[model samples]
Target chain A: MWSGWADIMDPHSLTKLNQCRRERRAAILLTDLGDGSDRVIVEGDAVDGALGDAVANAFRSGKSGTREVDGRAFFLNVHLPPPRLVMIGAVHISQALAPMAAIAGFDLQIIDPRTAFASPERFPNVRLDAEWPEDVLAREPLDAYCALAALTHDPKIDDPALTAALKADCFYIGALGSRKTHARRVERLTAAEISSASIGRIRAPIGLAIGAASPAEIAVAVLAEIIEALRSRGVGAERGKAA
Target chain B: MSQTMQSAPPKDPLTIAEEWLKDGKEVAIATVIETWGSAPRPIGSHLVINKDGLFEGSVSGGCVEGAVVTEAADVIADGKPRLLEFGVADETAWEVGLSCGGRIKVYVERLG
Candidate 1:
């Protein structure tokens, strides 16, 4: 007997089953019937037993269904939110910046090769990747909303991530270094064939020149710069619309 | 019932009245309704005093707390609200230490 019980009832599967069984709850999907007109129709309880199969059948047959409960039909639009901040260091600044980013509605993830530095105790509420930046960041999509910061001064850590970030057109790419260090960084990137225009996109001194001497003060400066960049982008977008 | 007489956290003289009535305790709330010259606390400052002489949230520094608390306890026991004024100009005000020469009017209400 091939019953639904054959699969262990995980929360997701259980939710789907429960949604199908409840008459008041409806599963909505936009569909086009073969009549050249796209209209929504409610599914009945009989189709509940094969809800997953029905959805698959609709897609396979190029048709969709809109389930109705209490005369209201909702169309599901699966829009994924953007990728978040990908910090390439597990330093003290990252520790302070992670919580502030979380509060500002960022999905914060830290990537560092050092296992001791990326431990859970240091970053209690952040996602930690104990792999090198290039390996870890390669798994994630870097969209325009994505923020990538290279907090490590080491070329081994910063170089690979900066290369990836430049290729991806990440919205914000910042590297923490002194003026002299950034000069050396530019020379290194030039050797790697990154153009001056791409290098200009980086906030090399990493923060507003606030004379920050402590990790906490530096974190504030970095966040302030990020906020200013985001705001300037927004203003430019609005001006483009006015034109 | 007045709007301030609603049973909520004491916003003013009237709200404190309702809170005291609900708790079945004699209490006084002193509101800094008006102030002149350099005052330590601004207008709308509140100090709540119960019949037991316990209080919360300050209205002034050491200069006025003792006298305000005493006056508040008296108002709570009397079940009458009175506007009490004190400042550096008043002869007895020196005892309360408001020597900064600022005048303040406190509305003391028996919140019972």
Candidate 2:
């Protein structure tokens, strides 16, 4: 089967696939359609294609699956950027969180307006955005690939970051704080018009309750909780249930 | 002049294939189209091979790389795409130490 010849994927589809990769847009590649055919479909445009629904669904799960279109089977390969963890504070916890997240196959970035907290000296080799959460989030925006965490205990910083994350519909929204502090934060967010359902989405006291004592332990807890939310879709969708 | 250092990001499979083609390498790309059971790698994982046996990336973790490379050599020469399959039934799995290895379906195609 390896010695026959033909370029089944048209140049037009090939160009679209390349463009999607360059833009970091999710795309589904459908190949091996019996006639040695291949087609790369980008999101939003897939539904118009022959295997549109399969492409759209595979895009969400980020995995490859086979579908039988008529008697012939086709494989849909989903491709998207690596998952990203956007840290809202450059705290001691974040210092530990960044490298661990990278090791877990997540692209990590620290966002803080305070220059002292976000300096390159402190966060060497990490993506540091030295702008207020609201401003930076507004400019760059967040997508499904992102997991946003607010590590700063300060309301002035963490609250706005959570608010932005909710709007972006981040898969995971974690806030580092005590239960008492989260209650106060909730009150403020309620006052700011963030819905109860949205507030519930925040993984308060962030991280799994592993009886963490120090910043490093807390970082471990946080990363663990984030993974739970990521791997367990039900856990991540807890906010939707609040409605 | 002191130059600043920046960390380069990982390139996607298409970009790697394009680069290989640009470098005047005769390339055939093997992509994991479908998998059953414990697929160590996700779908869309790619292995690009040149006529000279040089390869980049992987389709399966390691179970069928040698077979894919040998097939890819024919693909590069014949210009015909082949859909290849490897499973636990294949003796290569025992050699690769994959425990009752899963079935992996890869599509090997020539990319110009």
lDDT per residue as tens, model 1, B15-79 = 34345545766656566656788878866466877787877666666678898888776665655
User: Ten consecutive residues with minimal summed lDDT in candidate 1 chain B?
Assistant: B1-10
Give the per-residue lDDT of model 2 (tens digit) for A114-157: 88898888988888987788888877788766899998888899
lDDT against the true structure, per candidate, is: 0.64, 0.77
Clashing pairs in 2: A4-B80, A5-B79, A5-B80
User: What would the per-residue lDDT of candidate 1 be over residues A1-243, giving only the tens digit for each residue?
Assistant: 122221111123323323432332223322111111111223322333343344434422322224343343312211113337888899999999888887877777788898988888898867888888877767764655577889989999989998888888766889999889999999999998999989988998998889888998898888877766644443444367569
At residue A32, candidate 1 shows an lDDT of: 17
DockQ of each: 0.01, 0.28
Which numbered prediction scores highest in TM-score against the true structure? Answer: 2
Candidate 1 RMSD to the real structure: 22.4
For each candidate in turn, the TM-score is: 0.45, 0.71
Top lDDT hit: 2
Q: Provide the TM-score of chain B versus the true chain B for each model in turn.
A: 0.75, 0.82
